[model samples]
Target: MAKLVLTRLGGTLKGRALTPNPLPRILWRSLSTEGESQDPSIDPFLHSAPEGLAFGRLTGIGRNTLKTDVIHYLEGCKLSINDVKFDYNRAYTPVGVLLQFPSRSSFDLAVRQTIRKGRLYKLEKIDRSEWDLKTSYDGKAVLLQGVPRNALQEDVERFLSGCNFDPSSFQTFVRPGFPDPIRVAIIQFPTQVDAMNAFCVKNRSFCLNNPISMRVLQ
Candidate 1:
């Protein structure tokens, strides 16, 4: 039988029957003098979820630390759990755990993130002869990296207006803060160097180590 034990610290000990299967339940507890603060080792609860497990939570220093510990623990257990967390804020570097999830889940998460995150705009793919821009010039869509606070849609529009391509055809993405959403923008440039330059200058916040390919409709 599933047992649901609902407890709000200092409030009530409400108990509801729950399934025997191991799903999850919320255990709210008042900040007791003894458990006032979580120990770094036991923090972020996800680590305690059992080996070869998966979950999510609010992001913070403690959460991050917990993640590290969880990874180490998993390694010790000879287990690999798929980790997934939303980056609505876009502030957290989408590395480590971000790269750990299943590939399909990662792609779906990214698409959903693009929808709820923020306003999307188009930017030009500037090309310098140094990098490969052939694909971008072929009218294929490309991804640009940027941060929300720093991205100027107008500036991007104006810069791309003079280029051979239509500025309105592409989209711009700046990493937003917590609860915002994760997104990647698409654009077409004459060469890879231009695409790279724009990405570096605009999407500096993402710390994106590699560029993603875009499929241009036009």
Candidate 2:
């Protein structure tokens, strides 16, 4: 009976030998318990904005352009300006100005009047959804194809900065089951206007390589 018991114990040890580095069951249980303890209602990166505010992009406007000039231009238009921001690219070149208006209808009317009056700057309304980095519902993200496999995240970020936009996050992806692995990058911007400007100014080469093509995610 002792010999039979020893044989059974030896068999169990041999089976365990197949998995030499087995993890403790308690550790796995702890990990699972921690995962289950997390609350689903909380998100760390969500951004919220006030309701009734409208956003618009203005081109052909310089950073040094006097604010008083703009105010005088819009005087008697019945529209109120909440805020004005000037955005610049990595090259220190001015991209344009972003304006916040009190009402969407007033913003649209202002754009039309600017176009009809042949103002120095052109205006276009941008949806608020474009500012939400989480959803990226309005193609606030861009994808670059044919990126060199050896390229690093810093290289991509630097190149994008030169184009006048900063990336919130940069990620590289490889397709599975392909004979030769093809790598691409998905870059998310803080705002949709940046992504749109990058897309509009296409056909530019970066990394001292081929002229890469960029696609805006819809």
Candidate 3:
């Protein structure tokens, strides 16, 4: 036998039916107002199914705060997510996430919004540059450090272009963290020879008003 319990809040269903096996305690907690908002606008659970999806990484988050912090942020944006996987084995700190968006537009919106949250948390693209060690570089990647937080894509491209690397073939990334002047960036070169050249000139600064250090990804 089972008992049906119904409750409504903010024009949404808030209660659940109880069965012999019962639902997980976590599902019930999600029904509560623990990390939810009374206002429907920012409520993560108030959205309709999204039409597309995108993926991003969230650092500085822990196992306990996964639902409350990361998922809550996504919900606040009105984007529906299907699943979230953590990269515990790859990253020692285990601060990674794969966000499934409803559509490309939804993903773009999430990326734009979460970039603002990067100051407080590590949020960035989970592309090959971040993961996929072998394919990420293809033995032609250079790691740059000490990049100014405000450095734009063009700024990095301009500097790398001056070094005779095809700016189109290269990709840059800045890990999310506090507003520090120095950050890490990875540049994937077109060929291993170019990577070796970039690596040969180590400890030299480029890409901003201040010089940044570069190293070949091993």
Candidate 4:
């Protein structure tokens, strides 16, 4: 985004200057917190999602934007929307949106229209190939690294439930990633004990398989 400053002198506009706007404090803090919050020993690329496209990423918009927000903005512009459909994707750097357009021609048309008419915030076509590198944890979710991008959602969940970690208590949200060699995931256990076992400890070593702190379980 650009910052515009209008100089007013003697009740008359003197000149106008435009410059790049600085990133907001809150957003910067969140990105910076990624490293601070995660375990330093866990490699950034270690548990990265290789298949990458778990969710589509869109640019030229705020990370927190919702589908209705875009629809309302477009409606204000009196734009036609009979041919387009979209959804909100996960938040990422710069900005991102999850969009599901019906056709390629419609997608391309949207690109041109948004660029030309969207004077405030431009909307980019939703793409499936782009993925997010910001993987997050709630401290105890079992982390599974080296996942294949082509793996099915069911398969991923099944793997987590069937792992060495006790599966009886495994009833939670299994989602994820980072940008390393392959895909990464978590087992979504309800308790630390359920995520731990003979595999988790040996000779006073903790290996819960998660890259995050797990509440300093290390």
Candidate 5:
């Protein structure tokens, strides 16, 4: 009869044949568990925000803070925040949060807005706190060149309908030396998302007698 060798039975093949090593099952399992623990996915590497993405920080965050509270606060302020990626704890325990925004304009607006203290979410300020804006913007206004000098404000607004742009926000600028009758019109939108959507009208026919080109300034 074969003798029990740790977790399995071991028998000699013939006379003087050596038995298999008698390693304990617990030890074997421990080695396998250690291998699994070394998986790269569970690594504790500290990652920073990637390039081209706007980043911001919110302090005084608690473990009890819910994602819903953050969403509600953002929507309440009409912030066109979209596709925001979050990292709760860059450390062991929950300290605060880091936010990454795909939309630079949205990030600019959000960091400038005041977030009032609510039931669950708390901040250092008793009344309110502004999200720390860590990025800069060259500009967000749309510039339309070669606009017909004769086009009225009402005519421009009609062509820019559904773009959420304020009718009174369009301004015309003309170079003093250049004698070209064409004028440049700069239009501003309420939110960054609106500015993004403003590009959808690029192909739409703006004038019948004049040539015009539009571009969103960085």
Candidate 6:
């Protein structure tokens, strides 16, 4: 397992009151229990607004930061990550397939919004602690872990229906045999077993002869 050594959360200043960046909101996923999924209704990551926060509520500064891809920027840092694993799984959510989008920023924005919507099953945040950073695989992958959410297939399909991109333009499958729309994909897994089950399902529409390769932080 990757060691989480950093304990202090950073903050930003809005005039005089110190406040946390949303990245810390993302990090709350890391602080939650391992492997055990939680109720979406109770997730702190989704409920971050202080008591009475509303969607689309943002200070000008926060708005700018809201659009910021904090996770994307952090992915480039030469840090340690430990106990990393990777496996190819069927495309389950828009983010799973969207990760392959040519524009990284757009992909990041979509993911943040989806998580904020409060319905999908989420996993731990990418291990961003110094120890997790130091142990991460170099050049193999920038995004280390993902959590699957229970996205409404209809909701996702409706979102994609409006997109200019061809539904077929993205990767489709024969191994897992996904239909016109795939209902799920691997986001992040807490263990290799879970990741593998997600990736190498024997009866699923898609099938991987070999498990998708995963890497560990050295």
lDDT of 5 by residue, 116-167 (tens): 3342333222111222432211124566666677788777777777778777
Lowest-scoring 10 consecutive residues by lDDT in candidate 6?
A: 53-62
Model 6 C-alpha lDDT per residue in residues 163-218, reported as the tens digit of each score = 22222212222233334332232133345444334334322221222112222211
Give the per-residue Cα lDDT of candidate 3 at 11. 92
Writing each residue's lDDT as its tens digit, candidate 4 over 85-187 gives 2322331122444444544454555566566865554555334443232332222344444445556556555444444544442332324444444344445
Greater-lDDT candidate between 1 and 4: 4
- Judged by lDDT relative to the true structure, which candidate is superior, 3 or 6? 3
Candidate 1 vs candidate 3: the TM-score winner is 3
- Residue 96 displacement in candidate 6 (angstroms): 21
Residue lDDT tens for model 3, 36-153: 5576656576666445445566666654343335567766455332345545432123445555454667667666766676655666655634433323233466767777778887
Which ranges of candidate 3 are over 4 A from the true structure? Answer: 1-136, 176-182
Reference-based TM-score of each model: 0.22, 0.34, 0.34, 0.25, 0.34, 0.16
RMSD values, in order shown: 26.0, 25.1, 24.1, 28.0, 18.9, 30.6
Model 2 RMSD to the real structure? 25.1
- Model 1, runs deviating above 4 Å: 1-142, 145-153, 158-166, 172-177, 182-184, 200-218
> Candidate 1, residues 50-132: lDDT per residue as tens digits?
43322222222232233334345333222242342222233333222221323334334433543444523111112222122
What is the lDDT, from 0 to 100, of the residue 41 in candidate 1?
66
Candidate 5 stretches with Cα past 4 Å from truth are: 1-139, 176-181
Tell me the deviation in Å of residue 169 in model 6.
25
Better of 2 and 5 by lDDT: 2
What total of clashing residue pairs does each candidate reach?
27, 1, 11, 7, 0, 29
Q: After superposition, how far is residue 36 of candidate 2 from its true place, in Å?
A: 41
